[model samples]
Structures are given as C-alpha cells and as structure tokens.
Target: MTVVIETRDLGKTYRETVALADVTLSLEKDTIYGLLGRNGAGKSTLMSIITAQNFASTGEVRVFGEDPYENAAVLGRMCFVRESQKYPDDFKPGQAFAAARMFFPNWDQDLADDLVKAFLLPMNRRIKKLSRGQLSAVGVIIGLAARAEITFFDEPYLGLDAVARQIFYDRLLEDYAEHPRTIVLSSHLIDEVANLLEHVIVLDQGRVLIDASADDLRGRAVTVVGDASAVSGFTSGREVLHTESLGRVTSATVLGTIDAAERDRLTAAGLDIAPVSLQQLVVRLTQKEEVR
Candidate 1:
C-alpha cells in the first residue's frame, strides 16, 4: 500500500502542556484506521497537525510526501470533519453543503442529498438553530459525501443517537467499499467502530501507546477466570492488565498470546479463558501505569 501520511518525531505543545510527544507513524492508502484514546489523549491534536489546521511544535508531518502547511494541492486531497464544526450564523444546511461541494473536488451531491434524507436534516433551517444531532448529521453527510483521498473524522458521532450513529457507520462502510480511500476515524466509542478499522492506533498521555493491525491487537491479551487462588497462580508471572474478584471467583486479564498447550493447561487447572474485545484491551492498556 502507498503511504498517504507520515509523521516523524511529531511533537505538539501548548505552553507547558504536551499535546503530542515524539509521535511517529504512517497511514497507508485505501485503509481504515482507528485513532483511539481517552479524552485529551492527543487524538484530535495529531489529526489537526496532519491536516495543517495547527502547527506542530517540533518534528515533521508529510501528507502525500509533502508538507501540508499552506499546500493547497495536498490539503485539497484531505478532508477533516471536526467534532464541533462552525458555520456562518445565517447559513443553513443547504448552504453548508454548497460550500463543501465547492471545496472538495470529489464531493458527491447525489450522496449528500441521500444522506440529508436519511439523517432527516432540515435543509433550510439555520445551522445554529438545528439540534445537536442534526448539526452532527450535517458533518457526517459532508464527511461521507466529500470522498476525499484521505478523510479524517474527529468524533463524528457526537450527539447522534444509537440508530443515527449506526446509519453513519453503515453509509461510511458502503461508500468506502465502492470507492476505497484512506480514512482515519477518531472516536471514543471504541467497540462501536472496532469492526470498521483495519488498523488501530492508540494514544495515551500524548504518546503512542499501541499501533498494530486490528487482528494482531485482538489476540494480544486474554482473560483468565476461575477460583481466585488458581487464577492468581496462573497469571502470577504474566503481565496482568486488569483484575476483578467476586468472593472466591476472580477474573484476571493478562497480556500475551495463549497457545493450544497453554489453553489446555489453563483448562486443566479449572480456569476459563475468555477473549478480550478491542475495547476492553484498549481500556486496560491505557489504564496501565507503564505501557512502553
């Protein structure tokens, strides 16, 4: 796959507060990447720097092998849908769509029209008067319809109900399949978008915590549940991410792969092995004091 975005030792700081620290990664063409972490984890900051919306304090960012800062050619190929996108006070949803149509070269008006109906967004209503969900629908519609070579969705599901959120996800996947493009989705609802991600990049405390394929990450940890004493004994030498106990029963989530032989050993010890979901794994990994 061709590399669409690359960052080398990227660092961003606001006064004494560090937003991103020595972050280095590459995003490939036609791939769906999940930019995941807790609030204030620098997910948005990194995206902002890559999209040239903000300046980096140190290091470099390359979008399509060129600096994105003030570069119209590179910037035009990328679309960023911010969580709280502001529009003109008098502009309506239709006007917003019109502006987006002129900006994004690949913008699809037909798809935008379909999304407006699906999201039940009022075209003529002033954007400021629209409900929070409706406002988010406007951004989702633009993000999906823009079809830029590389698109970034920064918390695009905010204020959207479960049903509406599902619609966004469905439409995004459908359009992506028909027209493959590089997409970076920053979302707090990890499990909700886990299936859509081909690659996963996790940030914690302004640093890269995890960067790996979704498949590899899925098997990076396992939960052992059984009698407290047995579970403790089995997980004694392993890296325990999290642990829970209910009277004599305990569940310990540990890092590392469990082979067939190890599984047999665990079962013989009367311990139940459970697979950890992506959400659980990320939460546990980020909660750790030292993940490096």
Candidate 2:
C-alpha cells in the first residue's frame, strides 16, 4: 500500500511544555487507523498539525507526498472532524451540511441527508440551539458525507448516544469499503472501536508508545490466572504488566504471547489462560504499574 501520511521526528511545544515529542509514524493509504490515548496525551495536537490547522515546532509532515502546511492542493484532500467544530451561531444544521457539500469535492448530499434523518437532527434549529449530542451528530454526518481522500475524526462522537454512535461506525465502515480512503480516528473509547481499527497507535504523555497492527497487538500480551503460588511461579522470569490477588488466587498479565511450551506448562500447573482486552492492555501499558 502507498503511504498517505508520514511524519519524521515530529515535535510540538507550547510555551515551556511539550505537546508531542520525537514522534515518527507512517499511515498507509485506504486503511483504518485508531489513534488512542488519554486526554492531554497529544492525540489532538498531532491531528491538528497533520491537518495543517496548527504548526509543528519541529520535524516534518507529508500528506500524499507533499507538505500540508499552506498547501491547498494537499489540504483539499483532507477533512478534519473535531468535537468542537464551530459554525455560525445562527447557522442551522441544514445550512452546515449545504456548506460542507460546497467545500468537499466528493461530497454526497444524499448520504448527508440520510444521516441527518438517522440521527434525528433538527435541520431548522440554529446550531447553538442543538444539544451536545445533536451537535456531535452534525460533525459525524459531515465527516462521513464529505468523502475526502483522508478524513481525521478527533473524538467526533463525544456526546452521541450508543445508537447514534453505532450508526456513525456502521456508516463509516460501509462508506470506507466503497470509497477506500485513508481514515484516522482519534478516540478514547478503546474497546468499543477496537474491532474497527486495522492499526493502533497509542501515545503516553507526548510520546508514541505502541504502533502496530491489531493482530500483532492482540497477541502482544496475555493473562494467566490460578492459585497465588502457581501464578507467581509461572510469572517469575517474565515481563509482568499487571497482577491481582484475592485470597489465595491470583491473575497476572504479561508482555509476551504464550507459545506452545508456555501453554503446556501453564496447563500442567492448572492455570487458566485468557486473552487480554485491548483496552486493558493499553491502560496497563500507559499507566503506572502497581507493585506486587
């Protein structure tokens, strides 16, 4: 696959604090990528810089083999959907969608109209009169209907209900299958969106921690549970991520996958093996580890 987005030693600083640090990543064309991290972890900052909404203090960014900053040709191919997308206070939802149709070359009015009805968004109401969930729906609708070559959604489902969110996800996947464009989704709902992601990029503080395919990440860690003594014995020379003890029972998460030999040993010791949730695995990786 061709590379659509690339960054080298990307860094951003605000006053004396670092927003993003020494990050290098490449995004392949026509793939769904999940950019995940806790709030204030530089996910938004990176998205802003990549979309040319903000400047990078250091390093380089290239979209479609060209610099995005001040480059309308490259910028025209990208659509950024953010939680706080602003519109004129007097503008109605219908007006917003109409404006988006004009700006995005491949805009699909039928799709936009369908999403408006599906989300139950009030078209005639002023933008400021809509509830948070309704406002979020407007962003989601535009993001999907614009059909830009590269779309970046930065927590676009912030206040949407479960049903609305599911609709957004379903529409995104369906349109992606038909259009086949590069889509980068920055979200905090890790487990909910895990299945939609082909690749996962996790950030801790301001640095990139994990960047790998979902398949590789699924097998990157495993948990073992059994009697305290047996579990402790099994985990002794391994890289442990998390551990929990209750009475005489214990469960632990380790950094490596369980191979045939390891599995046989655990089975012989009457221990149980389970796959770790991507959310739990990431939480452990980015959080302060507890002492046993």
Candidate 3:
C-alpha cells in the first residue's frame, strides 16, 4: 500500500495560541484511522490543514503526493463530512445531493438514494428546516455515497439516535469492504469506534502522543487483579496507571507487555489477568501526558 497523506513538522498558530505543533505523521492507503483526542487537542485543526481548509504556520502537508491547497485534483477525490456542513439557506436535501454528485468523481447515486430512504430524510424540505439528526444523515449519505479516495469525517454522528448511528457504522463497513479507501475519522466516541479502526493516532496538547496499530495498542497495557500484597510485589517497578482495592483484594492497571513467563508468575500468585480496552489506554496515556 502507498502513503496516502504525510505531514512534516506541521505547526499552526493563532497569535499566541498554538493549535498544532511539530506534528509529523503519515496515513496509509485503504485503511481506517481514528484521530482520537480531547477537545482543543488539534484533531480538527490537523484535518482542516490537510484538507486545505486552513493554513499551517509551519511545516508541510502532502496528499496523494501533492499539495492540497486549492488543488482541484486532490480536493475532488477527498470528501470531508462534519456536523456543521453548511449550505445556502434556501438549499434543500435534493439540491445538496445534486451538488455532491457533480463535485465528487466517484459519486454513487444508487447508494445516495438508498441512504436517503434509510435515514428517512426529506428531499424537498430546505436544509435549514431539517432536524439535527436528519441533517447529520445528509452528511453521512454524501460521505458514503461520494466514495472519495480519502474521506474525513469530523464528528459526523452529532444528533443521530443509537439505531441511526449503528446504521451508519453498518453501512460504512459494508461499503468499505467492497471499495477500499483511506478514511480518517475524528471523534470523541472512543470505545464505540475502537473496533472499527485499523490504526490509532492519539493527539494531546497539539502534538502526536500515540501512533500504532490497533492490535499493538491493545497489547500495550494489561490489568491485574489479586491480593494487595501479591499485586504490590508483582508491580513493584512497573508503571501502574490506575489501582483500586477492596479489603484484601486489589486491581491494578499497568502499562507494558506482560510476557508469558510474567503471566504464569501472576497466575501462580492467584492473580487474574485481563486485556485493557483502547478507551482506557488512551485515557491513561493522555492523563500521563498532561502530568508531564
């Protein structure tokens, strides 16, 4: 696979405020990437810069081996879906779909039509007259139907109900299986998207904090539960992220690869070993970054 996008020492500033800094990163072709971070952590800013919606104060960005700044070749193959998708006040859902069809090279009217019915969106109604959930459906429909080679979804499930959100996930997976493309999803719904993402890039305080395969990140930490003394002895020199105790029993979440030998030793000490969720790992990692 080829590198779909790359950034070198990317930095952005607004007067005295730094929105992004020293952020060198790469995204590969035909992969699902989660741009996870807290608010004001540069997820949106980075996306804006890459899509040429904003400029960087320093560094460079390349999309499909060329600059994306007002470049029609690059922009035409990219689709950016966000909660705040805007249109003229008098524009209707039908008009929005028409415009997307004309703009995107790989637009799929069949898929768009199916999505419209699936989401129960009103075609003739003005976009401004639609409910929040209905409005989100319009963006989701365009994002999926456009079939852009590089798709960026920034919190696209804003007002969707549980069922509607699941529908979006199911459709995305179904379509992606048939048409592989590079996708960057910036979202705060960590645990929900953990299973969908093939790679993870965690940002903190306007810098890259964690970048690794989802499987590797899953194994980066482990939780151990056992007697307080035994747990203490086992984790004596390790980095303990979080700990809890009740009477003589204690549970500790620690960072590092717990090997087979260590697992056996933990079992021998009557300790239970468990896998750490991606959400928990991200939370701990960001908290640690804050402390530093």
Candidate 4:
C-alpha cells in the first residue's frame, strides 16, 4: 500500500509538558483509520501537527512526500474538521458551504446540497446561533462535501443524535465507495465505528501503543474464563490486561493469541475462550497504561 502520510520521530512539547514523544507512524493511501486513545493521549496534538496547524518540537512529517506547512498543493488536498470548529459569527450554513466549494477543487455542490437537506441544517441561521447538533452537522457536511484526498475528522459527531450520526456514517461510506480516499477518524465512540475501520492506531501517554490492521488487532487479545487457579496458571508469564474473579470462576483478558497446542491446553483445563472486540481491547490497553 502507498503511504500517504509519514511521520518520523515526531515530538511536541509545550513548556514543561510533552504532548507527543518520539512517535513514528504511517497512514496508508485509500484506507480508513480509527485513531483511538484516551483524552490527553496526544491524539489532538498529533493531528494538529500533521495538518501543519502547529509545529513539532522534533522530527518531521511528510504529506504526499513533501512538507505540509504552507504547502498549498498539499494543504488544498486535505481538510481537517474539528468538533469545536468556529466560523464567522455572521456566517450561515450556505456561506460555509460556499467557502468550502471555493477552497476544495473537488468540491461537489450537488452532494453538499443533498447533505444540507439530509442533515436538516438551516441555511439562514447564523452559525453562532445554531444548536450543537446543527453545528456538528455543518462540520460533517463540509468534511464530506469537500472530498479532500486526506480528511481528518476530530470527533465530528459530537452532540449528534444516534440517527444523525448514522446518517454521517452512511453518507461517508457511500461517498467513499465512489471515491476512495484516505480518512482518519479520531473518536471515542469505538464500537459505533469499529466495522468501518480498515486499520487502527492507538496512542497512550504521547506514545504509539498499537498500530496494525484492524483484523489483526481483533485477534491480538483473547479472554479466558474458568476456575481461578487454572486460569491464573494458564495466563501466567503472559501479558494480562485485565482480570476478574467471581468466587471460584475467573476471567482474564490476555494479550497474545492461542495456538493449536495452547488451545488444546485451554480445553483440557476446561477454560472457555472468548473473542475480544476492538473496543474492549483498546480499553484494556489504555487502562493498563494508567499504573505504568
């Protein structure tokens, strides 16, 4: 796969605090990536630097094999839509769409028009006066309508109802099917978008915790439940993310897959093996970072 964005030894600092530290990752072309991490894990700061909205303290970033800062050719092909995006107080939804139309060469007015209706966005309401849902709709509409090559949506569904969020997802998938572009979605609503991700990148404490294919990530961890002593013995010397015991029964989430022999051992020990979801694995991974 072609690498659309590459960062090498990236680091960002603000005074005495490190926001991003020695991070290196690549985003492949024409793929959907779920950027997952807890708050203050440097997800936002990483996005800011990738979009060239902020400078990194160390290392470098290349978008399309060139710097993104003040590079119009690269900047015009990418759009970063934030959850708390601000516009001119007097501007309306139509004005926002018009500005995006002028900015993105691939902007589709027809699609923008259709999305405005689908989102039920008021054309004349001042952006400052719109409700939170409406504001989110504005961002979603722009992010979708712009049709940029690399689009970054930073929690773009905030304040949107379930139905509206679904609309955004549906529209995104439909459009992406027609025009495959690289998309990075940073969201806390993991399960909701789990199926849409082709790849997953997890950040913890300003570091890259995990970066791999979503399918591989799903099989990286498994939960074993059985007698406490047996389960503990089975998981001994392995990476355990979480463990719980209810009387004689014990359930443990362990990092690493079970092979043929291990599976036989688990079965002989009467332990039940359960698959772990992407969301559950991420929670355990980040939560496990708390005490370290």
Q: State the displacement of the C-alpha of residue 221, model 3, in Å, after optimal TM-score superposition.
A: 0.5
Q: What TM-score, computed on C-alpha atoms, does each candidate reach?
A: 0.97, 0.97, 0.96, 0.96
Score candidate 1 by lDDT: 0.94
Off by over 4 Å in 1: 290-292
What are the per-model numbers of colliding residue pairs?
0, 0, 0, 0
Task: Write model 2 residue lDDT over 15-113, tens digit each, in one string.
Answer: 999999999999999999999988889999999999999999999999999999899899889999999999999999989988988889999999998
Better of 2 and 4 by lDDT: 4
Tens-place lDDT digits, model 1, residues 1-292 = 7999999999999999999999999999999999999999999999999999999999999999999999999999999999898999899999999999999999999999999999999988999999999999999999999999999999867889999999999999999999999999999898999999999999998999999999999999999999999998988888999998999999999999999998999899999999999999999998894545
User: Ten-residue segment with the worst summed lDDT in candidate 4?
Assistant: 283-292
- What lDDT score is found at residue 165 in candidate 3? 86
Q: Of the candidates numbered 2 and 3, which has the greater lDDT value? A: 3
Q: Write the per-residue lDDT of candidate 4 for residues 95-160, one digit (tens) a residue.
A: 988999999999999998998899898898999999999999999999998999999999978779
For candidate 4, report its TM-score: 0.96
RMSD in order of candidates:
1.2, 1.6, 1.3, 1.4
Q: Candidate 4 overall Cα lDDT vs. reference?
A: 0.94
> lDDT of each structure?
0.94, 0.92, 0.93, 0.94
Candidate that would win on TM-score: 1
Cα-based lDDT at residue 84, candidate 1: 92
Q: Model 3: per-residue lDDT, tens digit, 1-292?
A: 7998999999999999999999999999999999999999999999999999999999999999999999999999899998798888899988999999999989999999999998999998999999999999999999999999999999978678888988988999999999999988888888888889999999998999999999899899999999999999988999988898999999999999988998999999899999999999999888887777
